[model samples]
Target: MSKQAATLEADPQLHEVFWIMAHEPALGDNLARIRVSKGLTQEDLEERSGVSVSTIRKLEQNDRKSARVSTLRRLAQALDVRTSDLFQPSPEPVSPLDESVHTDLFALRRTLKPVRGLSGIHMPDFDGEVTYESVRTSFLAANALYREDDYRAVVQTIPTLLLEAMTLVAEAGSPDSDRAARTLLSQTFQFSAQALIQLQQYDLAYQAITEGIANAELADDPLLGAWHVFNECWLFLREGRLEDSRRAALTTAETIEPRFSTGNPAEFATWGWLLLWASAAAVRNNQGDQAEDMLALAEAGAHRIQGQELEAPPFWAARGASTFAGFSPELIQIKAVEYAVVQGNTARALEIQDTIHLSGKLSSSTRHRHMLDVASAHASEHNTAESWAILRDLRTRVPHWLRYQSFARRVVDQLIEDRSRALRADQAEIATFLGIES
Candidate 1:
């Protein structure tokens, strides 16, 4: 039996603790084992990886459960392993009791990829008549929920939306109706994909995007397909497949490169959005020059769409005049701040943050994400009070959304670790909310 198993057997009270720890990334053990097998000391690995010796020690000793994905990438390159290899795979058939596995996620998974048998794939049953208008309305409502940061409602709404869209496709009578059904179905899948991505369910999100792309193809909508590919790039980034992310974004962006002079707002916005994703992947992968080039291209796209909020083509929903998809000047600035933070230039990050006034031009989700980066920048500069203030404000504004942000948790963890005195009430509250033991 494993040492963990033996230890759990020896002490019942330790069971819960061990169970929780088991779900965390097994980076420490993986690092130690890989380093030993390669016949390298910690110092040797540090020299090769350029990760600090102290950071390596903390990781290997299980004192740290997380590190920047780029740090893991460096170590993986040095060890000749995939970046994913440095973390343990999540246990299969995840426990229903696992806090991360919401019932709605399971519902979504079943709706997206139902079990198949010898006969064929089983389709979900819908009692109500599924009309094109009904599906469209539901899709818009779900998108609104997503924009409002009502994720739980979004998750609960998707299964029915998926079923309705699927039913509409199966029952579509005419050629035009069939195409319309497929278009809406593709969009529904995109919404599902985005929701899953927000919940950090990469594998499920990929499945959703793949299905969406297939539907987009059936509808002969390349722009819609490009949008799906954009989500895939995001999934790649979230999974730490930085090179894959960059390549996918760049390739798709080029395929749909808009003509600035003649292109509609949607085309420019979609293209710009893809370029931003590419830039993000490049920046995170340590290709600063490439990242800048991509960012500049994206900025040009944003300029082309200036003073306009263009809903990217195959519009998912009407989110009002102020909302849009893909690229905006504000989003570009946000990316600049994110890149500055990634480069460890905290001062530059804050300076960029100082210039932007919060405008309705960006969605609440986008604004909250930017705030997290600002908070992280403050934390990195050892400005804990400002960091705490940001966290507190975010928590107040988007409590449910704030809880799921791993970056926020990391920032809070750092604050707790670096504090010279006992945890302040606000710090303790944030830590508890994030499930971090203070």
Candidate 2:
């Protein structure tokens, strides 16, 4: 307790009330002290533990008296210390789900077993009559839907496209036509994997990706085959198999490197993109050296594009590029920022951040991530006020985005902990939205 918080007891003995208040450590101090010593900014903890920043702050400041056991548990997990240590470790034992509750976004385990032998009614034939041109148009439409991040639309459209492609394969009377049909089928499966991955259905995604790879090889389309490599890398990353992810990405890069000298926009961006994914995967897995090597390799490949987003059909999209600027320098720096943050090099990340021009250079999801990293950097530097300011800006610009992002929630939690009035109302709303008591 601080000097002003003291309370005198009536006719109290020497070992009574006054000494108790004076000697006992505040819960807030313990939480704050340990948090700082461990080099964790509140934002990092929020992302790791899903605890709010406000609760952590208040516990440190003594602005609040009590918190739930769950909050302490989360803080403990993020800090890599025992819950018992937080108390008096100098006040309360830390660690759980007090601040917020989230659906496990990357959980691979299925909840309920599937009902055995359940079958749906057969639907009407897709397009009634199938043709090569019709199937090709549908495939392109599915690709467009994927680009738009409309996973549901892609899911809805693929059945018709897949049915048509299968029809084409069956009717292909010549070896050449048969190969063409298989190639189209491969592309369809690749897209199915992409859509399912985004939807967080990993098992089904695995099946689709496997089938896609098989079809690609038979069709003899190296570009689509390389795409399968990219998809494989992506899947492993999400599965938390960092080494496997890195290997897949590296192997993909090696397999496709022979094609890089062509400067064909399709191959160039795809290669650069795979390398970037490798770098990102390495960063998360503590393979900093590998991440650096991957980014350097990616930068070299990005250079091959020469700042032009070339759309050579069936390789690069005519309407959309993989990234906002088409595998350009801005994209490279943004990825570098991600790596730097993971390395705990906030200063380097910030320096890189300043160099990049973000205007019109990012998609909504990508831009939100960039700002979240910026907020984390400031928080790590112990510049709480400035960090909160950045977070507030993020909230104002993308009000609903934070609610879905674990990082954003951490920043919101911190602002609330600091007792920032500007953040309280928002906090109440977010807490309610997350189904946690404010």
Candidate 3:
């Protein structure tokens, strides 16, 4: 099936299965065995399950660690077994859920205890102590790391943590774990939101932020509610929904006042982040006067909370800096390129791009995205030679299914379709980039 059709027809269940297989390395191997025994090729399973072939490959390679639960149930049905059968890891731990829960909890505790002890702080008493709150804390920790651009350290582990939290919540009969699970789910939403944004999947990012808000409400977490609004507004800003973004930010600030204002450092810090984000939106929309006012508010808020640090929240680090500290160099470069395009200044855009260095610290995935952006900006100016050259360089480092591939291809295809003089002038370079005839 075409990629678009496959996405539209994707089975949520199989997606969950792949999610599971991705998390549980042993389970993935087991599933692979089952598939082979059933005489199914990767393509066959992709057709049957509506999971992309690439995901199937990741599972069989034992490269991914967790998947969505909905996917597991579907895979079980496809394999003709109960969901329980999929988690038969050897050297059985107390319970699959507990094992999953404990792994995350231990890692978080290890990271936090030293900080707590050094500060001579007393930890809060657990109310129900069903491991719910502890798991929620773990999600927060992961979020901090994610926000710091430390994607490689936690990306493999977050999916499992989220899946485990979801499972626990689903099985809870009372309202006991509901709040904690919801909090954790909000973190999951944030993680997914950031990932989607990185991929430039704006619609999906909006969906994630919306879900995060729902989870925050369920958890009765006002701070998360504020965060949800802030991020949702951010999505709007990125998509040029400027008015909507401004309204959302203002509404969030109104709701978070006095209470959230005097709360934890993180809470106060979030207020700063929101104001900054909202200000940026205003600037984008040409609300120049409003933009300056909002930016002043953001600066004042950030200044108020400066140097106040906690153990740090998950995903908040990367997000925190970007939000309160102002735009990352990455996003700034993108905007510069965009502005150059708008002013019909292709040469300036290219010049600006040359100075916009890719972070040596960025992950392979992030680096690929940066290069694609550069290529795209060049393509926008009909610099076919330069665009094609950049795309060719990128193709060597990125995979076939990387999201940016579509963007780069769209540019090239449009150029070919136009059949302008530029196309003839750079046909060889274009052909080389497209791997076609000149």
Candidate 4:
């Protein structure tokens, strides 16, 4: 077993490091072991975790080596173990394998190569390879789920594939392979970041966007850079940094020059989306002139690519808008939030909250955004019970994968205070919901 695995096995507090080092699918092995130790089957994991039977089977075989963190966590819960338990090393045998076959089996296991290339590009120069088969299989599962439009599954698979790809690149160490893997990882980050944003994990998505910006710059890919900027702006907006978000979005929108050619419709669409979102942020910031100008530019840009199809030739061709109602929902959400805050229309804000897609694999930053909205809206209504309820719910979810450093906790704390301010004699329910003594 690797030092990481051993360390994790020995120290539960440091298990997260093991997850980072194990290259994604290691969670599967850990989950399988825990389940079997409990005398459970793949079907049992599926039934308990809400993961598909096929997924459970693949995980058991180590075929789906890159299952999502959330999926693994659920399985861990079902198996009555901490998610950290998945990072522990394989347990040692109580007794050595019977005399004659043990040595041969050990030799065979040691010599057998994993399905992926042992290239140093993917992972560090470690004891063994992370197996290309592992990464590829995981990628396929993710792509399959994406095609099926299963947003939850797609979000879960992205990070796993990214981790697997990183391991492969570290191991291979080929410049060309590294570049290719980086490109793949960049795509994975884009998907994951957006999914995280949708899931209301703003902080985690923000971190992803930061890394994504650096990667895009390294790759010298303008479109990728623009995408990262858009996500970064989205995060800023969610954080109520309206001015900063608008500034970022405006920058992306204005830079659509030589690089925003017909070859990359996605890039152009991103620019247009940024303009639209920026306008909304500007409106929130009370920059009326800026908002109007941006909105006009947004409409023009959207029209420019309305009917065209993306063609990646010597020069990229314009493609029509993405089918996701790309920028409309974001604009609506920002406007609604602004209206709620300004008019103190708590009911309106709460109603609008249902429209934003959130939960499961969302970046921590994005989750914070939704949580803030819930807290703020309820507080505005003087509904201490409701606000405290949301805060308590956040407390439950925060410990699962709250991996980012942001003001999320501060916002929750503020909400708690807001609820407490309005407490009545019989408001022990609110206190209990806030996890505070009555």
Which candidate wins on TM-score? 1
Give candidate 2's whole-model lDDT.
Answer: 0.59
lDDT of 1 at 331: 82
lDDT by residue (90-195, candidate 1, tens digit) is 4331221234447767788788789899999986677899788888888888888876766678878999999999999999999999999999999888888877
Which residue segments of model 4 deviate by more than 4 Å?
1-137, 143-159, 171-175, 258-264, 311-438
**Residue 188, candidate 2: alpha-carbon lDDT:** 76
| Residue runs of model 3 more than 4 Å from their true location after superposition | 1-163, 166-182, 192-208, 214-227, 234-242, 250-312, 315-334, 342-345, 358-370, 380-382, 404-406, 414-438
TM-score of 4: 0.42
TM-score of each prediction: 0.83, 0.63, 0.45, 0.42
Model 4 weakest 10-residue run by lDDT: 9-18
Winner on TM-score (2 vs 4): 2
Model 3 C-alpha lDDT per residue in residues 4-90, reported as the tens digit of each score: 211111110000011112135677777788888888898887877766788778867867444433345455556665444555422
lDDT of candidate 4 over 1-438, digit per residue (tens): 222222111110100111222344565666677888998877877888787788788866766433333455466667766444665322221111123423332221221222356663232223435765666566656655543434445544554566666667556667766655555555556555655554444555666677666666665676667766766765555444556777887877678642534524565566766776676665444454666677666555555565565332121111111222233334335445534543335688778876767423222333444565566666657765676566556545552222121222323334554553655643444334333343
Report model 3's TM-score to 2 decimal places.
0.45
| Model 3 local distance difference test score | 0.52
